[model samples]
Target: MVKQPAPDTTRRSEKSRRAIYDAALALVGEVGYPKTTIEGIAARAGVGKQTIYRWWSSKAEVLMEAFLDLGEQSAREAGQESYAFPDTGDLAADLKAVLRATVDELRDPRFEVPSRALAAEGVVNEQLGRELVAKLLEPSLQLYVDRLRTAQDTGEVRQDIDPRIALELFVSPLAQRWLQHTGPIDHTYTDTLVDYALYGLAPR
Candidate 1:
């Protein structure tokens, strides 16, 4: 068998990978995804295009990984161990806390521009849209799934409720607001979403 790369080589590769991710995010933000090219990413990242191709097959793949890394970084900076919804046993509070953090993230320029470009493209490109939802978005949503499941177990949520669909009640509204410019996104808004989702809209 051929010899594998040394540890130092692997570290260098990781460093290069991060640089490529940063370059891709910046380029997509500045120029939009369709205009972001492998060559441009390579130049901005100071890596060869072959290096990017060695790991990812296309610009879309690169951008997807780039966005994932950005989200993880944001979560870590916010004192979260991972980008998962919290399960503090208080369903409303946990949901509101996470959503408030998300509101801050949505307003972050580094995330907003590139994410907007991808969202715009996804609206018209079904394949890319599904891919983005499946790969970059669904995993995060699953955290809410887990939280909702716990709420169901504790009788906080209705026993017959579908956690997957139920979680979307609060989650999707914020997502739509940010994606489509439908409404404002802030802590108070998200807090109210949590309350409305749990208590219902019919004069509780």
Candidate 2:
């Protein structure tokens, strides 16, 4: 007698969870955070509100998790380790490479649309903003700090410099450009930012 396998409830739950994440990201991107609702996410996801409630407490939690999943998924697709700074012995090359990848991420509609919506909400919702920064933003920044500290140890960077503040020279400018649409962003722009940050404007 041939034996059939039983249904995989774990697989089913994972599918449902992925659908919920997709629905939450799409809804927030399309409608913005202020108008997005748990009910709406459930309807779009083709799942019951109770399904979402079983996993998360509120819309904010679901949306945040969705973004986190999106980042991880993107990282997987790119074959890059999420939140790990690249180390190629040459700090400048490594930073430039990561920044270029960041530019690519920022340019993607799937990321940019929902990201803008979240950024706008985070500006006004203090708790949500803090949580988002703590969960999604700070870890990546910490990677930069760690990398810079390594550079200091190697005599590639000044020991007296604060890695946190020093990172802002390159990171903040690119972020401001992307967030504000103040200028165009591309590989060349990011590469230049890295060079300028490391070498400064003074002629050699």
Residue range with the least summed lDDT across 10 consecutive positions in model 1 = 1-10
Superposition error at 170 for model 1 (Å): 1.0
lDDT value, candidate 1, whole model: 0.88
TM-score of each: 0.92, 0.93
RMSD of 1: 3.1
Q: Write the per-residue lDDT of candidate 2 for residues 9-32, one digit (tens) a residue.
A: 588888998999999999999999
The parts of candidate 2 lying over 4 Å away from their true place are 1-9
Q: What are the clash counts of all predictions, listed in order? A: 0, 0
Best candidate according to lDDT? 2
Q: After superposition, how far is residue 16 of candidate 2 from its true place, in Å?
A: 0.5
